[model samples]
Target: MNIIDKALNIFAPGIAAKREQARTEVVRQQAVRKVTNSLIGGVGSNGRGYGKHGASTTKSSMLFWKTPVGDADTDIHQNVPKLRERARDLHMGSDIVAAAHKGLRTNIVGTGLRLNPAFDASYLGLTKEHAETLRSSIQREWALWADTTKCDAAGLNDFYELQGLAFISTLMSGDVFALMPSKPRPWSVYDLKVNLIEADRCATPPDKVNIDRERIQSGVEVDADGMVVAYHFSNRHPGAGGYSLSGSNEWVRVNKYGKRTGRVNVLHLFEAERPGQRRGIPVIAPIIESLKQLSQYTNAELAAAVITSMYTVFITTPADDEGGTPFDGVGMDDEDLDGAEDVPGATGDEIKLGQGAIMRTDPGEDVKFADPTRPNPNYEAFVRAMLKQIAAALELPYEILTKQFTSSYSASRGALLEAWKMYRMRRAWLSKTFCQPIYEEWFVEAVSKGRIDAPGIFDDPAIFAAYTKAEWHGPSQGLLDPTKEVQAAVMRMDNNLSTGTRETAEINGGSWEDNVQQRAYEQTRLKKLGLVQAAPTVVTPSEPSNEGDEDNDDEEGGEQN
Candidate 1:
């Protein structure tokens, strides 16, 4: 067999076995670490730290370290176990890291991170003008701030903190920059550094003007007007299983006669508007009524049912009319219906076209009401219940309860009062969850790459992909396996050699001998750098050649005459 095949056969199995063992051990070790961390207030698997509730299963949900209390801290040691659990309970995994990595790579390198040199070169080769053009519009507000304020480094730091609020604004929109390999990092190389260049400005403002400016800036003006109201509910019909929560507790816009107002922009009303569709798991309400009913189901069964019931609520809920056309047609479209084919027509030309009837439909009944002055409170309550159910399923705190934002509810200022508040809170929590670990590594990488002076932006994916490919897997050894019965020729040679038969071992056919030489060649290539020795020579029997064949044969037959 060729050198490649021989080498693969020799090493593949061991690598595979090692990888599998590592994976299994990681999980097993993580389980053990939880017990350790709970007892000792430390993380076990990666030695990073215990996550919330003392589980090292989730990286995103990892708990930040607190300075240990008392003097026993000296004995506590940090460890990095070779085998780390591959996944965590409700924790970030390889997929998440890969995705985050992909995004960052693309942003930094001007292309996706595909691990290809050609891709990287193509992206990096972009003209200066083109690269600059792709960057998002530089916000002028920061420039104004730097120019207006004559602050020292300390004051500048405070200003930066305030400006970070803008980053939160970006995060809540679900498109903020994030990094991977986050822990042990203080800043991300992938993150673009936001520079506040001081601009030439006039004299300082008076005291009265400064106070007014502070009040204006501090007002709720910066909150998002746009909101996404997501309703999470269970598949259950009612009772404890029927809980719902508002998923989109963020700002949504307000529209007055088609004119928009408020700091936030849009309104998204997402609901599981279907029957029997489960969107989230149900929660066991500690209330006596809920607990009594929940006693019938086990935790596993209840969790499943809760999930199903939430889907039901989401699917069954009616569409939010935030962007809906006003359907005012019941009496107004009488003329059109009169002339329509379904109804015996009186006059086609006199028919008016608009909305249809507004009667509520039930099984074998249509309930008609004279008044349509206000929204059905019962329906609103149903929506609230759906959101509450989601919170229950997720085991969220009461403070994180469900809320709704409606253009009508905001008195035309904006519909997202509660949503805006929730978004701010969620952003803060999520930021803490996202930022700390990433910053450290990012800064080092950036400094090394000479990108410290570069503007703040995500790495381009294309270049990042190329770099990763060259750096990570390029040098990594491929999986290999070694077995005695790897090739047909090897097996045959082994048989001939072991039998001590003259068939191949004879001067004319040394197949086994040739295989040994091939194997040696492959061994050198497969070995780690500077680890392999020179390939040993394996001598093979030379092929026979006919020389004076006829004369010799004739002489032997003639009996030496």
Candidate 2:
């Protein structure tokens, strides 16, 4: 501070200020650099950073890190095809996947689709006789399309098969299409045919399809409101081997409705994941990684078990003049070991030991058998935990998924009840999105063909909708304790908590009206045969006497005494 400060003050009076300003500038630049770095590279609160390209400093960064979060329709357009392939592969390869599909199909579709027509008697102002006639006529007309041989050229047989196929398709692929064709068939009341189109045929729009004006994205054409207007399907499946004369992939445009009348002709069946979602994502998409890992784990366990079952022998031989051959002195024709000849000989110094074989070892040589322990002790517990997670992801109960009920009755029942909620939701979705629409279309055809009599069908949309109102019945949720469940159902009905129609449908998958009609028919037949049916016994509780009367009787008796 003595000589240098004195010289700086003499040479430059502003030297101190200049040095201070330089230091301040350096700090300011540092602050600016820090801010700029922060702006350019997104610094997270946890001290982890992400670069411009979304390359993160976090250890868990994945390839999909930069993948933008898109809406449902966008997600489907980008990922659904790959998801479909993966899901199909899983369904084919994984037992769990197959079981899930089978369970869903069985629970949702069951034996067949039963129609319960709920026509409003008062609204239509129809007499009892007229309603009966209309219902009977509708049923008869439905039978034509319900038959598998009459419905489609594929010989699907009935709507049950159609339902099962459609459900499976929707699960495997993102969507399924049902084309309503006007083909004259001898068996059908209306010249209606249903053809199921797979997702493969609905590829990206071809060059001539005009993706701009048509607003076609991923094979589906949408209007300004984002409603699907048409579907552009390849004439043949992309995987199918065929040649078009035009030397290009031929595509056909199928409108959602008939061009002339604006009547619906195509039914697209898929559960919408978003409001404007054009397609669906496979149900198995979320659990694919878990499934693959599970498959690998299962295979490894099986292989380990197989390895553990085999006996491994280790041989040690003393140094010998014959180059360490253990069977040097063992005679080939020795009768003591008759089956020793069957054991193949090893080359050079190699010793091959098999079951029921003797090896002549050099005097001090030892032969020990290895007892291998495999299939890790924690394997079952790990698998069970993993399965629980997988089941949760699929919205299924682990017991149902595994078909193993090791829990108590109450626990199992609780799991089933919880699982049924999901199943019921899916069933309702399927019914609404697929079955109801198809039924409404069928109703329209039946009314138009004069097969079923309904006034004001075309003029009044409300009446048309009312006429199409119907309920679909599937398999019943059978009782765990039949007597108790039946009694409970009866009590509910008696207390007006439920109805006979609902109870009948829940228990037997039969319409209450149909059951009543069948009962009446049976009664008529019995009466015709002069057989008396047993009447139901009614038990009434006895009334209690008044307490005052009992006291009065006792007092009178005492006075008389």
Candidate 3:
């Protein structure tokens, strides 16, 4: 080193170190630039602004934790058991949680989703009368299969009731499974029986080794293409059933589709929220933490209120001839006190607080009243707020979730309508994933057995879909104002916007054709009784329509508590 540089380093070591660090940084940048320039494609646009938004690594402490980019199933596989457990726990323990699931079940598949058979006559090249005949035949056969004695494998519930159970289970348990294992009944012609398997039973066996290249996750066996090929269903529920079958574990690996027939054997019913998500997330997963917190808060508040409501009396005892505390600061047992009633909440002390309750203390003791400032003034508001959050997470309106419709007519109706949207969506999903497949399978069996006449169904997928293509109508959204709703329905019908058949289903969940035939029979019987009257005049669209009274309380009135 130069004499002057050596002297400066000894005198100003910090300045010399700073100079060397700057030179090293310059060299590092040059190396980075050279490597970057060699690549055919440049680095992501402006480094994709990775230091902020979505996944961040900025100065903010909140952005410090980095999330992995693993596939959906990989992330959810380990967490499934806990998620399902908590969901079921909530359903069993919390009334609000149970009500959420119940509301879904009621609104989505009340009674059951009724099959409205719509046979495609155009492609099938069948006459309208022929189509109608086919529909009637199918409906008759469907009724026989839907019987409680024949439809369910256990014969516990009819097909309609099964629908509600399965859908509710799906919400509470993340998913549900149906095994279409047929066993013929002595009297029933249909051998198709639906056996619902709990989500817990359908999972990879405990002793399973990676023998095959296929990945088995949460009971679902997926191929290299990420397509679910089969499900491993244990004979016993893994969550409850003992994991043993005569000393060895057993699991039935049911294929998604039959080997030769291509019919789906195991129906894995779940709503996939992400691509490659092999299983469903419980409906309340997003709100689990909030639910737990709110539940705890509610419990704490209730306990506090209860404790505060309790009235305890402390009397000062007279000491011989001086003033002092009573009972020697010891609690007296109920057996020692005559005419003493046991307190509801008090332990080791007498705290009975009945109306006009008279307490006889020791002589010279004076009574001191205990104040119970309880029943929080803000309790209702806080509970309502929490319920609103939970309702939003559940995709239900607050009024619908709580069944507290003490609002204006518009508000009540709006809440109902909003809840119906979610209900309808869930119903459609259930019908598509659960009901339709089962029906199709049942129909296929019926066709093969010569119970129903069909041509080219097995050969043509289109014809098969058309024949099986049906609409499921669950419970109708009941009217808030019957007269107003009826008038609106009539108006739409007069304008050719809706049909009587559709209106019948929407109004009271009935088949218009069935209603018409029933009406006709009733009219005939009435005429035979000689009680017939002149037909009511039909109101045409050109006729003047009556406007609703503005003074009526229809707009603001709502259901009473």
lDDT of each: 0.30, 0.74, 0.78
- lDDT tens per residue, model 2, 1-561: 567657777898699667668879999998887787777654542344443235554446544455677766566677888888899999999998999888878877877657778788778788999988888888777877875557764665577688888888888887888887778866456666678999878765557445574377778887887777888888777656774524667778889977798878788888776776677777788889899899999998897676445455666776678466554445443543444322245553344333456555555678888776675888888888898898888888887888775555555566778888987887787788777877887787787787778889788878877788887777776776565567778878878999887788788887787888999999999999999977955433334423233334444322211
User: How high a TM-score does candidate 1 get?
Assistant: 0.17
Higher-lDDT candidate of 2 and 3: 3
Q: Which candidate number maximizes lDDT? A: 3
lDDT of 2 at 422: 85
Best-to-worst ranking by TM-score: 3, 2, 1
TM-score against native, each model = 0.17, 0.78, 0.83
Against the correct fold, how does model 3 do in TM-score?
A: 0.83
Q: Write out the backbone clash pairs for model 3.
A: 203-219, 317-326
Model 1 scores what on Cα lDDT?
0.30
Segments of candidate 1 deviating more than 4 angstroms: 1-407, 411-415, 453-561
lDDT of 3 by residue, 194-236 (tens): 9998888887766664555348877788888878888988777
Measured with C-alpha atoms, the lDDT of residue 114 in candidate 2 is 74
Judge candidate 1 at residue 50 and give its lDDT: 45
